[model samples]
Target: MYCKHCRQVMDNDFCPDCRKATRMPEADDICFLAERGHPWSDILCDVLKQEGIPFLRQSNLGHGLMSMIGQGLELESIYVNWKDWERAVDVAAGLFSEDVEILWDEEDELQE
Candidate 1:
């Protein structure tokens, strides 16, 4: 498939190069959950899975570079469907301590 916004070939609804959704966001559309480096991202992914939440991890360094560097020097952006955002955020908060604030939205006053 091709991204309607960037006109680039895409394998899914999200445009990796553009770092945005290719189509209009539906109730189940993917949304950014968090951005973390290395071990944290890996840990978060594992926790999300244990809680039965579906997630996608996108590497800032791209697949080829991530394969080469193993995501050690870059951040990974985690995404979950809009329908799962609340649950995913709860899972994230439970995984981290109070001092480790996980901000889902700027206007959302709710921090964990």
Candidate 2:
């Protein structure tokens, strides 16, 4: 177990040295759900927030010129706590699916 903020080994929920909260170590029983580059990822995240579920979002986006050229990198991964994984999965499936329909399309390319 380690504290993400302090990079120190953790024995409890709070780091002893830094006294900061540390996420529970991942165990065999721990579960997670991930969404990759899906436009609906934002909506799903909002739903999870509304439902009071803890989650982590890992988005991979390019910076500067590369990003502007490619509309940024395309990985937006959402991970949820094991207990909430099922709920998140249901929301992703029942409400939103892999093939999410484009709600609206607007071009916002920088013009300079």
Candidate 3:
């Protein structure tokens, strides 16, 4: 398949040129979108849901700490399948430009 982000001919599931998965992504192929605390995460999640973009909301804190301190207090990370990444990003950008913390440089790690 061809990469949606970068129209490169793909040899494997992931595009060699763009380093983005061109096929159906697995759990390991999920791409990080942003990190936020409490209501912000909830708001973004709701927007993603409304846009029909599948996503995963995970707490950055350890499970024990999250449980003890409460989910609201800990930072939450948003991840999305490679296929829906562009759309999810657009949604996030439209909603929160400055506050959304996206680790742009770290996206290269997904290629590995």
Candidate 4:
């Protein structure tokens, strides 16, 4: 398998490229779970780390520039492998509980 985070070929559950876990459940693959402005993104990342879920935080450089240019691009998002999507979501939901809102209104637009 390949690591969803670094796109490197993985020999096992742990990615040698990024040195993170790669065996995420397929059902928990909630790519682009939250936007950049949402506080939940950071919180969920932390929670995922604490729960041992492999995830990645991605942001569009253009979006950052747009934000500075007053165009206000969409927020950055969190992503996980297709395998890990549901478990990751569950972990986030368990951690954040009622605070788990759809921060990314744009849906799954993240690039792999």
Candidate 5:
């Protein structure tokens, strides 16, 4: 989500400007589905939403007392409701396919 004050992309639910949670709808459930990077995670979430599947994004923290005391490793991940898992995956795959096709068309033009 974009910050209201600075208009920059927010790192988490809380907007840096107002120090309040962004007024976006929360997902019904959460499941760690995919983890490529920030960009891919964002894209996947968007695809799921476009397909009417609800989801939430999350990340692992390291170099902290909580990390050392609780979890041993840090791993970024994305999540969707169990009910929406299959449909979300399908939608993400379709989005990827469309992106690939667009890239192919651009490449074909470059080749010509």
Candidate 6:
């Protein structure tokens, strides 16, 4: 399977590169895209729409708190049916160079 977030080709379901669990969206889930921050996320969404891939953007209540505390964590995400994961990933990958993509891990503990 492919890691939709970082576009890594993983042997198992999990993406070792991104250190995040990967799963196909259930029939009822709308989360096709991973949690992406603003600006870039906005561009991605536009591209997805332009490509005619159906998806949804989801936000959590913590976003409000993050804004209030100025944490600036990106909770916004794009979602699509699991069935479209491949095409959706392809469309997203074509927009940028895979050689330079950076993967941000929120769950990583600070070494410092």
lDDT of each: 0.73, 0.61, 0.74, 0.61, 0.56, 0.63
Task: Give the TM-scores of the predictions, in the order they appear.
Answer: 0.58, 0.50, 0.57, 0.45, 0.45, 0.51
Ten contiguous residues with the weakest lDDT in model 6: 103-112
- Report the C-alpha lDDT of model 3 over 7-34, residue by residue, as the tens digit: 3334488787778788644433567788
Q: Which candidate would rank higher by lDDT, 2 or 3?
A: 3
Window of ten residues with lowest summed lDDT in model 4: 103-112
Give per-residue CA lDDT, model 1, range 69-98, as digits (tens).
775788988988767877988877776655
lDDT of 4 by residue, 1-112 (tens): 4456754434588876678887543454445444454555666786676567788887655765766755344455777765666677687667566754545524334532
The candidate scoring highest on lDDT is: 3
- Expressed as tens digits, the lDDT of each residue in 1-112 for candidate 5 is 4343432333577876678665433344344456645456656665566567766665666457545665434345666665676676677667666646323234434754
Candidate 6 Cα outliers beyond 4 Å, as residue runs: 1-31, 60-63, 98-112
Question: What's the candidate order when arranged by decreasing TM-score?
Answer: 1, 3, 6, 2, 4, 5
- Candidate 6 residue lDDT tens string, 1-112: 5556654344578877777876643444443456677666776777777667788876653756777866356557677765676677786777554555545434433533
lDDT of 1 at 80: 85
List clashing residue pairs in candidate 2: none
How high is the lDDT of residue 74 in model 4? Answer: 41
Q: Which candidate's TM-score is highest? A: 1
**Model 5 segments more than 4 A misplaced:** 1-29, 61-75, 96-112
Off by over 4 Å in 1: 1-25, 63-70, 98-112
Q: All candidates: CA RMSD in angstroms?
A: 10.3, 10.2, 12.6, 11.9, 12.9, 12.6
Which parts of model 3 are misplaced by more than 4 Å?
1-28, 70-72, 98-112
